[model samples]
Target: MPIRMVDDPQDPQESNNDGGGGGGNSNFPGGGGGGGLFNLLPLLLGLFRGKGIIFLLIIGAGAYFLFGRGGGGCNMGNLSDLGGLARGGFLDPKQFERANIYEPLADDNTKNPIPEKANLMAYAPAVGNQGEQGSCVAWSSAYAARTILEASRSGQQGEATKFSPAFLYNQIGLDGCQGSYILRAMEYMTKQGSVPYDKFPYTDRDCSRQPDQSLIRDAGAFKMRGFNRLSLGDRNDAIDLRAIKENLAQGAPVVIGMMVGPSFMQGMMGQEVWQPQAGDDQMSGFGGHAMCVVGYDDSKFGGAFLIMNSWGPEWGRNGFGWVRYNHFKYFVREAYGLEPMPKTGAAATAAFTCEVGLVQVTQQGNKMVAGSYAPLRSISNNVFETVSPLAIGSRFKMEVKNSTECYIYVFGKETDGTSYTLFPYPNANDATKTKYSPFCGITGTRVFPHDKSMTPDSIGTRDVMAVVVSREPIDWYETNRKISSNPASDYASRVNAAFAGKQVSNVRFQSTGKGTMQFTTAPSQNQVVAAIVEITKR
Candidate 1:
């Protein structure tokens, strides 16, 4: 009852060359086993049944899965490529535990990386009296500390931690000019236990007397001697990367400074206010007067150099400036001292809000013009009034505000009463434009939305004012268009109607008070006046 099994006729031929064989080699062209045509037929049929047909169906299924149903491409690489999936490693538990960390994760659509810190430190005091030569170092040091302390607690809970230069100065009980010897101040601060000198090692002799440079003409030698004598651990002397990074990370204040010769004074004097000139180097003009090392640079300069300044924020770029590598050495040797210590105690805890403001009004015949009124004021404490009666071909400050947003504008006014809006303003809308918008309508008006806007109430109480004096004819067409289309009011009816088609010549100020001011100069100057009016949030 045993039966023999028969092989299927469609089975592949037994030959090695055919790539399908049971035991025989298929190298021969014409073998006794099977003809090439017969072998090809079975092979093709087998492929069609098992692979070609199935492969085509699989490809169609894959295409449908990707394009037809929005399944997305098969990016089978790192899991991180998939949104929110961790590919590198497990998520840090601390990251999840920290409330402030991973804030971007809560929102699925957020693309911005989370910031390391929640808030940055704002400049301290916001405003202070310009310090004298002897007091400058002490003033600057105290200011630096206070600034760092304020910045450190910006995003933390409760009232911001504050520092007082005056208090620190009193506590340390060191008094001398900023250019004077720093050894005394350092010793006094150390003795008072205000700062730890464990990391600082310098005898009084190291910083006591000024270098006798009468015969030493070499700037290099002068630089070397001072650098060598400076104590390694001294906050002013040592370029401690770890400390600097830690302080910045913790929001601590660090002081930096630079050295300059009398040439600095010459540079300042050459300016228009001190001495007018066709072209002058503005950088050398300021950063003169004293030596101050407040903070260090973070780039390739790393902690090698410090940030120093001669004037307040009103003087330099927001009162923030930088110095070169080891530049403070020359100043330290020449001045023979470090910055003074800061004031301590409850005064350091005092808090004050800072605000900036601008007011603009047109001028005619040495008097303010009417319907050309714009009075801008800040509700905050910090206010800087620009040097007013701004000369023709000169610049002035322009303020723009909404309830939630605020901005400052700087512009130039012409002697003939015509004014031109400058770079910063026009570039704000579209950053690519090379030529500034000269049309009065385009330049003068600043629009702000009422909802979530920057308004007078939002700004608080600080105020500043600037006036443009010019002799050119006002561009009436441009001025009228700006006023009419302004978001604040119906300027077409209120302003354009009165002087609709008049060849407006002379203009004057109507009034200026409480976050508002108006001016009436020539049509050209009106543009500047209009800019000032628009800046005021009220």
Candidate 2:
């Protein structure tokens, strides 16, 4: 058996056609040599013969066990729902892993040339409500991001645009009925951007399976340089109140996750200006309650923050009110701010050699399952330029500044356009843990005696991308996969190279990122830092 690097089935960036080549054991119930429905007779008969329960479940759940072997079909909604309320603007605790990857940069004050004390909300449009759905995160985040775009345009907020939370919720594969994480929601907005509310509009039903691209293809969507997590003492601790004020003073509202409890609910319902004191209730209710911090007033209501709640204009002083600073801190859990970027034809193109700050990677088994880029801490760090190509024996190095629980996987592509998984190759196999989940093994910062380097067998210019994820051994599962008898017509045939005898047996090392040092799998609180370098012979 051999392993293959295949393009993600769900991803659209790669071609869907699985090319016609390779041979192996039948990728289906019977030898992949018979005609259509008749070939399934044996499998169907076996289901009735003492395996009815398991057979029913496989058909019922419709889980894609065959990997990229399925045909394009209608995407029914709710089957894949995670029950997380597409919470518009939450910060995932997992993101803290790469928080310290870049050095801190100064804030840009030129965007807000107004006096130090001013409220951008004065120009903001009236707020809307989340209705019965747990979509406050989407509504609040859209409101804040929309207001920033509006202000930068007309220098006022009165005619503020309303972006669609429903569009974001459904398009990003979030379950609006169930509460969602704000940070995850914001990530979608930052990457794909959002459309106007009226275009797609919010609905109370299960999220739509597909987004209407017609509504999303315009230049109206506002894309930020990126979002920022504003913390107080330590990133793991409470958010710094001063930082919140500074961001608000810039006329851009900050998104904060407030703890929703009885007292706070009562305050919003009763008083025009709500201020619930700490310890009003000992019981914790629903968490991930987020709202926009529009502005702060040191003189008004004894030093409080002006908040824009997405409970409709009919609630809380016409959908907006104030929270005393002391009470605000007691309930607020996470804070984030979006730095506005100039509206370009599209997002800035990636430089040949870019130092993308705060790279986050999610680990699944031994593979780096997912990766995303965050804004650089400083504008001066945008040192992405191309130089003379590197030849063979060009040494590469990666240094970790703030170590966290993760293992690094460095991959390279050479001038000849050949790809290689430099580290965590065939050498990193664990034979004993055949059934353990991805996290049930050694996990921590890899303590390498020295920097790891690689040399190319062929000479040419090259570039590299390094991904760090939780330390775990890669696992492969064997199962029946449906395949077309006519391989030329099968799309899965292109990416099913794993089924062929594509074996590589050079065990240079014995573990991927798995090490003897064990660490907690819980979300990291502190930041992690690391860098990738490529040295070419001059």
Candidate 3:
């Protein structure tokens, strides 16, 4: 696991395989040079550029959540005292760590008048402390977003609205206390809204923290519209720094990462001004750390970035200090600019309607009797279709012929013109398991239900839209758990709005006919095995 500055201090261990030395709970895909045997299949599949490979991997891997920690784990370090400047690595999880001694490198005696300077503290709320948890990423991200939200409000300007970092740590599927990626934290705000601190206050970093009725009610109630990625190609420092300065100058607070070491710690403690020298990198020792870059002073200490630490107001100059520009680039791993979603009265009542049709399908019995349905004449287009209409509350069994290894997905569309996942319910068998439908072949007789209800306000005839996806939209399923158990009207509304008209040619199934023996009964040179059946109320 890579040491998170907030987890454990002296004994900083790697949290997980991040291609860096550390202990971790989640598995990094290609950490430490070799990605295990998992690398072989992806590497070979990489040659074939299409979405089918992605779908195959999902089914092949089974349900990672069922076995080990799903996705990679994060290592959060508990930062104690503040430190001054010392050249070290940013949160580059995949880099070599070479030990180096800590020393004072520069004097804060520059007299040049800086032209561009912005202090985010003016718009930000009170500084916060992360306590004993390794959640600097969460704290900094929440703080940054809160600052933007409060600043953007016309009437409540400077009235800081505390957003719950605890809610994000607990709900967003991140490993607790273990540090998480900075970008992931920002993205969480967009996907699942964060609430005011009064709703979900900060607690110790542990999985046992449960949500109360109040917490559940406010979950995803308020969200940021999106975030700006200030990263450059190949982790290019120069390009990233320029983007950071531009955003900061515009009064936007930025979230950044750093490699916390002895000298860096000493500066945070208010012992001395940090002045890092070039080539004194410390990537190996302590792991990654995240903080907010609130302002910049081009004339101070040979130009520096003013930082807001999550150690509360007593840490630095009221929980703030200046860092060398070189150290900012060297120690800062990633930076992001946040934008708050519209919260005005008009924005609240805004409604959207979809142009597409809804679909539903039902499998009546164990076998598809010869007279019940006709066989697909050919698999020419990306989508395969059936002429019959499907009804809501109807049950359907799907079968895939010719290939025993192919996976299947069932989708439902309502009268509101929205689509939803209808199979692979929560705790459902893996797509590769024979007991599961859509994914499994001959032995799979699982039934799919059109459970999504028509909103009382909806006025049109309800219908279901069926789509057979080759790949498992794992993230989709994970985010909207209801899609599996009982599809909700809100889930359909959200998904349709988010993915409307989004072209996904690469994600289609690609097991086409080869040589003389066709992969399927499709005359087209290529074939993507899929079916879209009209669903009506049974």
Which of candidates 1 and 3 is the stronger one according to TM-score?
3
Model 3 TM: 0.44
Highest lDDT model number: 3
TM-scores for all candidates: the values are 0.25, 0.45, 0.44
Angstrom error at residue 280, model 2: 2.9
Lowest lDDT 10-residue stretch of candidate 3: 99-108
**Which segments of candidate 2 are over 4 A away from where they belong?**
1-92, 95-116, 154-160, 173-176, 219-221, 281-283, 343-538
Off by over 4 Å in 3: 1-115, 154-159, 173-176, 205-207, 234-239, 271-273, 277-280, 340-538
Estimate, for each residue in 33-52, the C-alpha lDDT of model 3 and write its tens digit: 23333446667587656887
Q: Rank the candidates by TM-score, best first.
A: 2, 3, 1
Encode model 1's per-residue lDDT on 316-406: one tens digit a residue.
3344343322223322221222211222353232221112233232334433222222334322211222222222221122333221111
Reference-based lDDT, residue 276, model 2: 43
lDDT of each: 0.27, 0.42, 0.44
Error of 2 at 448 (Å): 29
